[model samples]
Target: MATLVLAACGTDAAAPADRDDVGARVFAANCATCHGPDLGGTDRGPPLLHEYYLPDHHPDVVFATAIANGVQAHHWDFGPMPAIGGLSDDEVAAVVAHVRDEQRRAGLME
Candidate 1:
């Protein structure tokens, strides 16, 4: 039974994710708790779907840094945000991509 299970699992542990799903997957797992399921604001966190977050204003680096180093509550009333240290730079990038895509879709880019 163990051999059958292992055989079904295959040898490649690092299977690639579908290109379109990367950002959302990362976001759902890591950022969704605070940022909300639809990237909208929650009681604990501000909305990423707002115009204030456009890359021209907040920039991608800001997102990366905020996730890595945490954020202070200067813009919203959510209070200070703490650093999320478990996510890697790549995962952070993926999360950022997902957020930017969401931001665009929300018409926040305008």
Candidate 2:
């Protein structure tokens, strides 16, 4: 797995409310099925807010790729995530921002 630093997104002081709204919408529309509404993970997927993931995997580029292209099922057998082709680059960025912020608030991101 890649060790992605959280600082790359810059100071966590820019448009937080907007990020949260975008993030919630993106997650609801695309990730809620697998990741769950509260981001607590689900039977079909691992928790995004867990200590094992959020901190190390929150890089913008990595997340962008994961959302835009989908990830290969390397650590789990559930399978790769389908490409969220419906989202534009800006939308993807917002989602990533949302995930990072929420994780950070949850004390999962560093």
Candidate 3:
């Protein structure tokens, strides 16, 4: 797992106040094992905070699709990702929101 520590800013204009807590909880429960608590890559998955994951390249829809159907390894050498079952659409959306928030916090996205 790759660990990335970024300096936190006082405020993030892009983060939704309502979604933040839900997103964080959802991500921590389901994604943190592989994606890390900070969205950094774990031994099991690639980092979501990288430039390759910036919204311009990987849109919100792409995330939803990936979570529902799984994604073949294209960027990282971590191998193919399996579909994550048992997550509702809302949960998936919250996870994406959390990841995007972390990305912005890391300055990987605007």
Highest-lDDT candidate: 3
Steric clash count of candidate 1: 0
Select the stronger candidate by TM-score from 1 and 3: 3
Instruction: For model 2, give the 10-residue run with minimal summed lDDT.
Output: 1-10
Clashing pairs in 2: none
Pairs clashing in candidate 3? none
Report each candidate's C-alpha RMSD, comma-separated, in the order given.
10.3, 4.5, 8.8
Q: Assess candidate 3 and give its TM-score to the true structure.
A: 0.81
Off by over 4 Å in 3: 1-15
Clashing pairs in 1: none
Which lDDT tens digits does candidate 1 get at residues 28-58?
8877888899989788898898877888888
Candidate 2 lDDT tens digits, 1-110:
11222342344444768767876898899988888888787888767777645635545677777776788876567778787778765566667777777788887656
lDDT winner between candidates 2 and 3: 3
The superposed Cα distance between candidate 1 and the true structure at residue 82, in angstroms, equals 1.1
